[model samples]
Target: MLDLTAPSFMRAPHEQLVRALDRSCFAETRIILFGKVKLVLGHPEIQDMLKDGGRFAVDARNAGHASPFGMKFLPASLRVLSDNLLALDDPRHRELRHMVDGPFRRIQIEQLAPSIRETADQLVDDMIRDGENDIVAGLCRELPLQVIFDLLGFSDETRGKLHDVMKGVAGGGSAFDVVRAIFRLKPAQAALRREFENVRSHPRPGLVSELANAGGDGGQMSDDELLAMVFVLFVAGHETTSHLLSTATYTLLMQPGAAYQFRRLGREARLVAIDELLRYCSPVQMTKPRHARRDMEFHGQSLKEGERVMGLLAAGNLDSRVFRNPTQLDLARRPNRHLGWGGGPHMCLGLHLARTEVLEALSVLFDRFQELALDTAPDNLRWTKRTGLRGLKALPLRLQ
Candidate 1:
């Protein structure tokens, strides 16, 4: 069994697992679940797995068994957060996606760009005034949290309340991890349930009203589904992006030439540079477990029906077959249609907004402090020890 908690593994699983990846396109990993499941490591193979919704299922019901995302350990009371898009397929997935995805479309999020930049600037200003060096708390966490809360029309008090709970979220999907997350979420779920009702009675700005009034779009999403959507939106909205912003900053600072190169780019070019960083750092290390729809031969491996498979997004990002010098950080690399943000039908729902926030956050940080540098030694920095995610615990910086 792979010891997920092993210090060496937690510190750098990719490096340790690289051999398995190099040896074969498909391997077995018990790190994520109780039973060993297929781990897709190659770039092309992972892409095929993610895109072939017919062959692979995010909702395990479509396969054969019922492996809902933590459904067994997940409490009924908290079904509100677990029964949403991540656990659905086909018409239902598309329907639920269409319901709330309106506000997140690039054109729509573009309208929020000005506000996003303002929030990024305000966060930077606050950090400077407080003489803060940790960019993770100063900006990475706050930028996305503020943006998502703003979209949800949440009050400052509510934002503060949920922020505390979300910040402490434990990542592995073990039974223990699931049980622990449930208790922490109950309070926040109740609070969100209230907000959903509030929006229904009185219209408000942002997605809260948009979703609370989703019935206007000729569909009725149940309360549990709605709650899951809202909560997932809130959590997913910030978590990965927070990591992306922090890790991107750390990567750039460590590579001064890359930092200098990024700074020279205009808005358009900076967006391109963001993709390269996304490819290099790969904030999301793995994807939700994908179940095989039926017994099939893939990349020479015989997969049984209902067998769980995981896409190693981080590993695929390092595939030499696709990316030249895959291990090296190249901020200017183009033709970079990497799985950093994900691919296919189930790609990140907030990709547009996330890209915009990370881009603006990076731009503001670099522009404000032309002499920015790491305040601490690289080895001393902390990283979040979570399965399927990559991020910094804190990114201390020096602004001169």
Candidate 2:
């Protein structure tokens, strides 16, 4: 059995974990740190669970879920925070997804590429001015935050406050720290509610305004629901994309000739490369725990009703049954069915936007700074301790 929460497992190199899990028993069960929750490994089995929502549900409120990092939560605040699409079942999940789906469609996200490219160029320019810097802070972190703020039509003051709240939440420290961030989220939700109202009244040209005007699927969203959706997008859109940018950059830089090879590819080819990077990097390593709505037999294992199971997305991506040479980063890999963005109904809402940001960032970084290299030894670089999300804490680099 794989013990994901073990100190050795957490500290081991990421690739080592992927390879080990891929070769382990297909039905191997692992216990997570939180209340010893069960993790579901194996590519096909995970894919089936994600797609089979009737059997496995995303909403864990009734799964007797424990507080994150074993923290004690304020029930009221926790309830509000947990009301997003990720935790919703069908009907409501389908309704809200429909409302926002138009804004995140591929064509709509493509329309924002020029601006995304401009943002990337500006960040690269600043990096060039600073001879040596942490790419995580200077480039990866700021780009996604800027793009998401622009898309959401946030004011400077509101953006700063949201950033502080999310930064605290993303810090992912001890149980006390996690609980503190959960409490802090209430005020952030209030601030976001104000922004939503502003956009609703003024009718701006961005996603916030679109969401405010959205209805007809299941009537207008309640203020609480709106807050929950925005909260989910704020964290998902900002943190995940930022981590992808940093990790993809780190991965490419570490591999000899990978960066140059990626840059030389044509636009269509570059998009394909980004997909492969998403698969190989697997930034969001695991999905939120899904509960078995009823007792079910899966792959010779029995699960009782309300039992929680987490899909190890990273492990699935590296499964040899799906991708040949799964461990290698093949930029041109095709027909890649990786679950990096997840699978089924709860797949990432901002995937197109995330892809645009990462592609533009990579292109701009290499185009401008041809001699960019790591300032610190690869072993000295730090990885974030966050359990579900894989990302660098900092990546210092030498730009010439």
Candidate 3:
């Protein structure tokens, strides 16, 4: 078993992990036991496995250990929250997926595109006025959190509370950070629960309200389910995008020529560049793990039942065979199919929101801040130690 506690992957550029996976692939390796659990990194084998969900299950309980969030706090509807789409297998998965996927329908998210762009623009204007700033704190973090709060119909006061909760939860320190963050969220969770109770009488026109009131033949969302969804959206929506924006900013600053090209090429060009950035940074390095139900062969290796599979999305994004010169950041590359937001039925539900946010933020940053430069060496910036997250702790910048 690889000692994950050794901090082997920590501090190293994400490339090191990709290289490790690549080597393992050529060696026809399997079962990389990191801290007792084996992580399957080979893409071709993983893709084939994920494709056949019948044999290779994605169900939560059957999949693996309890969710990190669940480990922190048990909600009223623990079963529903745990067994929701992401935690279910096959036919059962399809049922819950239909409900959650309803709101994220392309048409629904597309309608919200204008709102997303406006939010990005407004935040950028503030950044430009501030002169020098930490884009992560200033623009990247605020924009997505605000958008998700708005979608949940959270009042500004409640939104402020949520921000504090997220900061305390995601910021620094040891396991105590989780305790602190959870304490901060308690009040907000109570407020949200109250709102959920009153939701039927006075439904609001946001995603949370929609899920709260989803009924009849189609909707499977329970009150507890709605609360869990809100918490997930509030956290993941902003955190992942924050890293994306920060990393993309760092990438562009490093490659001025590419940044200039992205700005000059217009909307379509900017979109293409954003796609590449998503692939390159792949903000969420690891995903919630999936467990194997029965003994199976993966990449010519036999695996026994009761084992887990953690998808290394970063590894897939940097696969040398799939992406030419995968290490280099190429904004102009076409046919980019990065697994940044993920794939299959459990792909990121807020992908449209995320894509729109990245596009607008990049456009505004490059267009307005022509003199943007890194205030510190990118190498000097420390990456967050969290295994599943890839982002800088501090991104100091000078905007003249």
Candidate 4:
């Protein structure tokens, strides 16, 4: 059994376990995440399972079972988060995805390139003025949060409130901490509901306004679902991209050859480099748990209906059969079908925006500073303990 929740794996993922499972697509192995489940690490098999909505489902209801999470105990404010597109089955998921998909399309996101770069330059200027060194705190976290807040049309006050609320919510560790967090979140929850209503009557300039008015052929989402949708947007929109920025920058600092090649590439080639960077350090280590829709064998393994299986995306990225020299950071790697941003219907909606941010961020950064290097030793660098995401706690760099 692999305890992924352990501090060791959180600090830095070792590839030995993945190497051990190289002979098979998947093993009937025990792994603890939400609970014990079968783990898949092969690239082809995992990607296939992810794309096969008929065979596997994110919603347990589609598999004829109640949600395994004891979510009923949670307040409606919190419970509504589970009503997101990620938790829905076909038709509904497809519909919701299509409704919210307009703003995130590559063309729409590309229009924001100048503003994104402007924000990046401003952040860089702040870093230089303040003599800030921790890239995670100084640039990685702030840039994405600022961009998302701007995109959502959130006022500065709302951004501050939401920041505190999110910190309070995610900071909890024990039962006492959980109780404290719920109390802290109560006021913010009510305020956000009112904000959503305001968006309906008085339009805003961003995605929030469009989504607030959105009603596909299936009809409008309820207040709770709307809140959940926005919540998903706020969290997913910034969080994963921050990690991507942090880790990708760190990878570049670590590999000079890769960075050199990355710098020499054209715009299209640079985006490809970003794709390779995503695979090299998977922002999300694994896809959310998927359940079997029926009693069936998968890739030679037998199973029961509604059984849990986790796709180890990072390990899958390292599959030697799919990626040549899987461990090496090849900036020009072609046919990079790595599941870094995930794949299929549930693939990241903000991928275009994310790629834009990275491209502009790195371009402005390197173009500004001629010399950049890590301030702390690689061994001293820390990783976030939060499961499912891989990112640096800080990247202290000495730049000139």
Best by lDDT: 1
User: 1-400, model 2: which lDDT tens digit per residue?
Assistant: 6544444444344566566665652434443244656666678888898999778877754444453222344457677766688888787789888888877899999999999999888877787786638878787878877888888777777888888877666543334565678777767777778887887778877777777777785788878888778778877877778888888988889878899898789888988998998888877878887888778897777888777778888788887888898878899999999898888999999999999999998888777778978888977866765666767778887776
Task: List, residue by residue over 1-400, the lDDT tens digit for candidate 1.
Answer: 3344454654455565567667887766565344676678888999999889989988877888754752345456565565677778777888888887788899999899999999999988888899897889888888887888888788566677688776656332334554576678777777777777787899778777777776754387776787778667766767779888988898888775878888898988898888888887778877788888899998899989888888888888888889888777777788896898777777889999999999999988888789889999988877775656677878889876
Give per-residue CA lDDT, model 4, range 145-225, as digits (tens): 788878888655567877776544432133344456656665666766777788889987877777777776858877777
Off by over 4 Å in 2: 1-15, 22-33, 61-75, 130-132, 171-178
Any runs in candidate 3 off by more than 4 Å, and if so which? 1-15, 26-34, 63-85, 90-92, 127-132, 170-176, 218-220
Q: Write down the lDDT that model 2 would get.
A: 0.77
**52 Cα displacement, candidate 1 (Å):** 1.4
User: Best-fitting candidate, measured by TM-score?
Assistant: 1
TM-score of each predicted structure versus truth:
0.92, 0.91, 0.85, 0.91
lDDT score at residue 315, model 3, on the 0-100 scale = 73
Clashes of 4: 0
Better of 2 and 3 by TM-score: 2
Can you tell me which runs of candidate 4 are displaced by over 4 Å? 3-14, 27-33, 68-75, 167-183
lDDT score for residue 143 of model 3 = 84
Q: What TM-score does prediction 4 earn? A: 0.91
